[model samples]
Target: MAQLIDLKTFTDKRGNLTVIEKVVPFDIKRIFYIYGVDESKRGGHRHKQTIQAAICIQGSCRIYNNNGSSEAYFELNRPDKCLLIQPEDWHTMDQFTPDAILMVLASEYFDANDYIFEPYSAV
Candidate 1:
């Protein structure tokens, strides 16, 4: 199943600083961001070998995850909030705020065979 975690954050007079380190379970090979989305949804599939950590660096968005037998929903509204998506967890991102900037750290490089578009129920 996907897990939601809080990133370490430091706040002071200068503002807030959030850091991503030591917590991710895999070595990151790819980094990407999603922004300027309309009402449409994104990520309607799971991965075969890619684990991902998603952070809403700007605004907010809702994520739906299903790992075969279980399911969960996560809201990433802050830079300090992260959603760890396992390779087996099927997920979708929606309900994005206008200014939402979702950054994803991936465990593997791009491979067409690594993607599974079918839902868990269909599998």
Candidate 2:
């Protein structure tokens, strides 16, 4: 199951700030974001060793994750509402708003070998 992490947020009259640290099991080595995806499409892939924490910094989206035996759904609406994904967990992202910005913090750097495209028993 993925962990729903409520990240540290500091708010003031000016604006709000959220901090991303090494609170997960591994240090963040790569950061990326997804945008301009249609609602009919989704992220249909999983990692073998890389862990990720996904957040919606702008707009909203939904994420579905499965780990062979169990499944979970997450609504990434706020920047502080982070979904910490572990290895071997299959995930798909969809239901994105028009201007949604999905940010991801990865435990490892960009490596094509880290992706596991094997078919798992997930629906």
Candidate 3:
């Protein structure tokens, strides 16, 4: 089972910033963003070894994730809250606002062969 990481969100008169430096509980190796998708569009894929933590920095979106036998839905609307994604879990991102900015912190660097683009028929 994958764990959910709750990051600290600091606010001030100026603004706010949430930092997740190295040596934190979860090991982060890569950072990426998904943006500019059309309405109702979705990203369907899963990683073999990459664990991800995603945040909605600009707008709102929903994530549907399933771990073979169990499933979960996460509503990402705040920049401070992040959803931790486990390896080998099927995931789809949808219901995104027009200006949605989904930022992800990955546990491993990019490897094209590590991804499973097809859904598991047995699940």
Candidate 4:
């Protein structure tokens, strides 16, 4: 299953400042961002050992997650909305707004063997 975490934000006349602190269960080892996607979806697979937290820092996107027994859909429309995806959760991201910038924080370094391309049923 995937969990949604709201990041802490501080607002003032100057602006708003959001922070990513101790909420994530693992230490982040890789950071990436997705943008400029038009009519196409992303993330069709799940990891074998990595955990990821995704945040739409600019616009909005929808995430569909399936973990063998259950399924869930998450709309990340705010910068403070963080979706934590576990290793077993097979997820796909789509319906991205033009300005959307989806940032992902991963718990493990890049390893081809860590990725499982097949869905839960095939795996």
Candidate 5:
């Protein structure tokens, strides 16, 4: 199952900075981003080995994830909030605002074999 986590934020007049280090669930290896997304579009798959932490760096979006037996919906609105997705969790990201930008930190490099295409049942 995946969990929504509050990232550590540092601020002192130089704006706020969000940090997710090795102390988090997994060590980051691959960094990718998605933006200019349409509200009607969605991410429609899951991973087999890659662990992911998704953050909405620009605007708000909702992630629909299913953990085999159950499902849940998580909102990514703040830059300091991260949603950790495990290998078996089937997920789809949709309901994106006009200016939404999503940043993902992965535990491994891109490997096509690690991907799983599964239909999600939102809860």
Candidate 6:
């Protein structure tokens, strides 16, 4: 199962900056976003050894995660809150606000074979 990681965001007169350089548990190698989807649309099929941390930078989103035995729903709306997804966990992200921007931090570089696109199976 994945864990919720609450990040520290420092605000100042200039602006607000959230420093996540080497402070996060996983090694961030890639960054991506899921956006422009209509209602009832889902993303993320499966991952092998990749770990990801996702945050709703703008607007709100719901992430459905299943790790064979347990299922959990994470509602992300705050920029400081991020959900760290473990390997082999099947995640389906949906219920996004129209202007929602889902930012993801990946532990590994892009690898095509690391993703499983079929129906999720217990690993």
lDDT computed for candidate 5: 0.86
Model 5 Cα lDDT, one tens digit per residue, 1-123 = 889888889998889987776545777899998888875757678888988999999999999889787888999999999899998888899988889999999999999899889665454
Better of 4 and 6 by TM-score: 4
Clashing pairs in 4: none
Q: In lDDT terms, how accurate is model 6? A: 0.84
Please give the distance, in angstroms, between residue 50's alpha carbon in candidate 3 and its true position after superposition. Answer: 0.8
Whole-model lDDT per candidate: 0.95, 0.86, 0.80, 0.95, 0.86, 0.84
Off by over 4 Å in 1: none
- Superposing every Cα of model 6 onto the true structure, what RMSD results? 2.3
The C-alpha stretches of model 6 lying farther than 4 A from their native spots are 12-15, 118-123
Model 2 poorest ten-residue lDDT run: 114-123
Q: What is the lDDT of residue 2 in candidate 1?
A: 94
Each prediction's TM-score versus the true structure: 0.97, 0.91, 0.85, 0.96, 0.89, 0.86
User: Candidate 6 on 1-123: residue-level lDDT in tens?
Assistant: 878877888998998887666556876899999887688757566788899999888899999888877888999998888899987678888899999999999999999989876655653
Q: TM-score for candidate 4, please give it.
A: 0.96
- Those runs of model 4 whose alpha carbons end farther than 4 Å from true positions after fitting are none
Model 4, range 9-115, lDDT digits (tens) per residue?
99999999999999999999999999999989899999899999999999999999998888989999999999999999999999999999999999999999998
Whole-structure CA lDDT of model 1: 0.95
> How displaced is residue 5 in candidate 3, in Å?
3.4
What's the C-alpha lDDT at position 45 in model 3? 85
With candidate 6 superimposed using the best TM-score fit, by how many Å does residue 105's alpha carbon deviate from the native?
0.7
For model 3, give the 10-residue run with minimal summed lDDT: 19-28
Model 3 bad stretches (over 4 Å): 1-4, 22-25, 121-123
* Lowest lDDT block of 10, candidate 1: 114-123
Q: What CA RMSD would you report for each candidate?
A: 1.4, 1.5, 2.2, 1.6, 1.9, 2.3
Candidate 5 deviant stretches above 4 angstroms: 120-123
